[model samples]
Target: MMSITYRLPQVRNLVTAFPGPKSAELATRRKAAIAAGVASSLPVYAADADGGVILDVDGNSLVDLGSGIAVTTVGASNPGVVAAVQEAVTHFTHTCFMIAPYEGYVAVAEKLIEHTPGDHAKKVALFNSGAEAVENAVKIARIATKRQAIVVFDHAYHGRTNLTMAMTAKVMPYKQGFGPFAGEVYRVPMSYPYRDPEGLTGAEAAARALLLVEKQVGAENVAAVVIEPILGEGGFVVPAEGFLPALSAWCTANGAVFIADEIQSGFARTGAWFACDHEGVVPDLMTVAKGLAGGMPLSGVVGRAELMDASHASGLGGTYGGNPVACAASVAAFEAVEELRLLERARHIEGLIRQELGDLVGAGVVGELRGRGAMMALEFVKPGTSEPNPDAAKAVAGACLAEGVLILTCGTFGNIVRLLPPLVIGDDLLTDALGVLKKEILAAG
Candidate 1:
């Protein structure tokens, strides 16, 4: 593979103390201006980012391991994406696809159809966020199936909207005080091998979930079964091997739309274009965002032709659904994925991460190391026990940040530290980040 250049120096250079004077000022401003509900993982404010480094307002160059929550797989400031956005702005920014359509929107839809799983006839409807894409997918499924019930798994995170909040499983932050959630959204158990009872096979886990669906919410009344192929915010839990296939088959047999929320796991973040490709399980509808438009805000629901067209004309669109600039950026992102061979890159990263961090799991600091390709995680657990160790997770993250590496912690119990480094991250930078993470994990434990 050929080496790629970055605009910023790809090194973890702490010019000043972590959260230096400039970032401290920004934090003060943020406290007065930004809402308390909004939170930032790291306090430092970014001035520029490229490849694997984020140059903060304090001029501290920190290694980027979270990829801005998995949005910049191609790189934070990929040359192609930057140029595409610039060109698009010159032509015109927004016309709102509902009023006046543009070629970029249609072009993106074509790319979705060609790349997404299955050879079935498909159509696309663009949106502005992952939440919007998920909501629309549910809408389309409900309209087409003439059913109201939507089935989701435990440890699932669809989005932050009213309906998605109902779909989400965690209660403390995502759902607490956000009452009167949308009705008919049923939650079933997920196939969590690490936490499941001993000797429980993937097929057995599927049966357990299926039994609940049939007994609690009759299969006939179900409109859709929405799940993240690899649970994203829910700890990057890779479901047992046969679990996904069983659910897909059940949805097909029971006449329910199987929707894959690949918002964080899609594009080339995983070794495949989509996580469902791993199991050869094709979803009826797939919600995509995050990595879709490089760093631009864009999302979409790509699904079977008939179901996508079920909604009446003008029934599904937002004022900024398919922004032309976002679409252009998305086109460039798609090109980068192909031209840069990110699928192979992601696989290579998977090997490196596992080889580097697998020891922590054996040492009892990390309970499990799971996920695919560039989207792996380390679940912190109490020593020699399966109990969650959120304190360890927190400590490791803070320590990494103090040392000029950026890592993110997540999970229902917030005991998992997820690794989402840019696929274009340099080998040297990634190794340095992992070394910091390793030292911190050991110290925290």
Candidate 2:
């Protein structure tokens, strides 16, 4: 596999303290201009980024493990994506697919159809963000099924849109004060092996969730059952072995659409084209974004043609959905993934991370090491107990940031530190970053 050529040096070098004078000055300007509601995890201001490193204005090169929330699977500055975007802009910026439908839009749709799970006749509707894709998927599911209730899992995070906010589980940041949200969304238990009762099997967990749906919202009233194959923001939780298959089976038997929100786990981030592929559980409607466009804002809902076509002609669309430049980037991202063999690269990253951090489980600092491929995370907990330790997670993340390594934290309890490095990241750079992570995690104890 060939790696993308990046001009920026792929080494972590801190020439000045993090958020140095330049970044501090920018922060002041940002506070004045940007909304207070918007927050950034790191204080540094990135001037340039390529491969595995982000260069701050202060001349510090930080090793990136977050991948901008898993959007840059092919690296932030991939040559193919950059060239495609540049060439596309020269031809035309935006004609709005809703106005003068462009070939790039159709091409991206075609790519989505081919890559997304299932061989069934599929159609795709593009959108500007993952939230839009998810919202639209729910809309499509409701229209197709003529049902009123949507089922979601506990600790699930669909998005922040009104309807998605109703679908999401967390309250503080994503959903708090965001109401009144759309109604008819029901929550059920997810098969979180790390937290589930001892000796609970995947099938048993599915039965429990199904029983709740049956008792609360009848199967006849359910529009769709949406879940993340490998839950994102809710802690990179990889459901138990038979959980996904069981859910999919239940959805099939109940006439509810099984929608896999692969926004954070798609595009080779989880060592597969999609996480659903790991279990051979094809979703009726799959919402995709994040890594779809190599950092360009683009998202889509790809699924059964019958369901996608159920909506009225103008029922689905956005003025900026499937923008020409973004479509070009998406196409190039697909090519980059193919040429770089990012699926294999993701698996390699998983092996490396597991090998480096697996010992934490025995040390008792890590309650569990979950997730797949590059989308891995460490759930920090009190030694010899499952009690969450958000402080430990924060300390480890902060230490890594101070040492010029960028990491991200998630989970309902905020006790998990997620690692989402770009697939193009070099082995040496990844090793160095992991070393920093190990040292900090150990020190946190």
Candidate 3:
């Protein structure tokens, strides 16, 4: 096995139907108790999860290719996280960093500054979620640059909060009916190689986007240009080479803060400490969450010391911005990343996934197989054309689910199948999951 630390068997086993009786009952209960807006991709309910397997309420052992939407990079129930949390909870749970600060919070911030890119002096502020981190990042950028306008890209997904909803591009699910979003947020074109006009170089894409910012948003008014180095909810879109560097150069020249929203692609999820490392592009501010604290809810904005300190004391902080329990979990999670060598593990998973699914491209329905490390995706399109085919993506995911593998779909077109297995997954389990995925994808074609 791939050095699985969890006790659960690293196997996909379906003791009952996809959503067995227990899960079906839970789904029935969920309909009545949960909000209609909160939707679960699968009807199954988890009873326990560890390593690469999720033992559902129905007694099915599902192969976890989704990794709780890329949150459990070190695996759920990681021993380090569990032990640290257990120790921390026994001592104290909540001592909001703003009131009685603790070493765990400071330690976590130190870890973020150490891992984040750049040799420049850096500082960090923790938060409760990705949206909070992003909102605060914008606040810091604005205060530092004394500009109001915040620039984002097409197909970007920042968060669901008001400001983030304004930053987010998708309208149907996240932003629909959540209107009257925060203003001063501008949208720009992304470096989408597959969908961009043919032969458009990364620099060309950068120029095109910059022209829009200059003409429409006014570069002088732009406080921050926020983007995901690898688009997360926007289909794991890896920007074309030279795109990021060009943007960074423009931001520096114009004094607009370049914020890398590394929520879904940071903390060793993309085979590196952060996706920005792939291109050697360092941001003025970096927002991080998802895999930062294993499965705990913790997020942070780490950036240049001056910009991060632009806000006066007591200007930024929430009631539970840095819960002691969460901070302990984050410290443990960072240690797990180092102890388990998850950065290399992410790359190893990437090689396996590419070896298995790389050939699907240009094979009728699959137009692209892209993304780095464990955060990979397959874009489904109509045969012989670039037209999106979300149905094919859904069909493949459904087929895999029926056989006890869980995968997630994303993209503005909803035509991408994303794979985000825990970094601690075994080779055998991942191979089995990929086998199911490949078989179903071929079947769909």
C-alpha local distance difference test of each model = 0.94, 0.93, 0.93
Q: TM-score for all predictions?
A: 0.99, 0.99, 0.99
**Candidate 2 versus the native: TM-score?**
0.99
Candidate 2 C-alpha RMSD relative to the actual structure? 0.8
| lDDT digits (tens) for residues 1-445 of candidate 1 | 3478778888889989867999999899999999999988888899999999999998899999999999999999999999999999999988999899999999999999999999999999999999999999999999999999999999999889999999999997899998899999999999999999988888999999999999999999999999999999999999999999999999999999999999999998999999999999999999999999999999999999999999988999999998999999999999999998999999999999999999878576789999999999999999989999999999999999999999999899999999999999988999999999999888876
Per-residue lDDT tens digits of candidate 2, residues 1-445?
5745679989999999877999999999999999999999999899999999999999999999999999999999999999999999999999889999999999999998998888899999999999999999999999999998999999999988899999899997998887999989999999999999998999999999999999999999999999999999899999889999999998999899999999999999999999999989999999999999999999999999999999998999999999999999999999999988989999999999999889887475788888899999999999878999999999999999999999999999999999999999999999999999999988877
Of the pair 1 and 3, which is ahead by lDDT?
A: 1
Q: For residues 38-110, what per-residue lDDT tens digits would candidate 3 score against the true structure?
A: 9889879999999999999878999999988899999889999999899999998887788888898899999
Candidate 2 residue-wise lDDT at 307: 96
By lDDT rank, best first, the candidates go 1, 2, 3
Model 2, 148: alpha-carbon shift in Å?
1.1
C-alpha lDDT (0 to 100) for residue 192 of candidate 3: 96
**Global local distance difference test of model 2:** 0.93
How far residue 143's Cα lies from its native spot in candidate 1, in Å, is 0.2
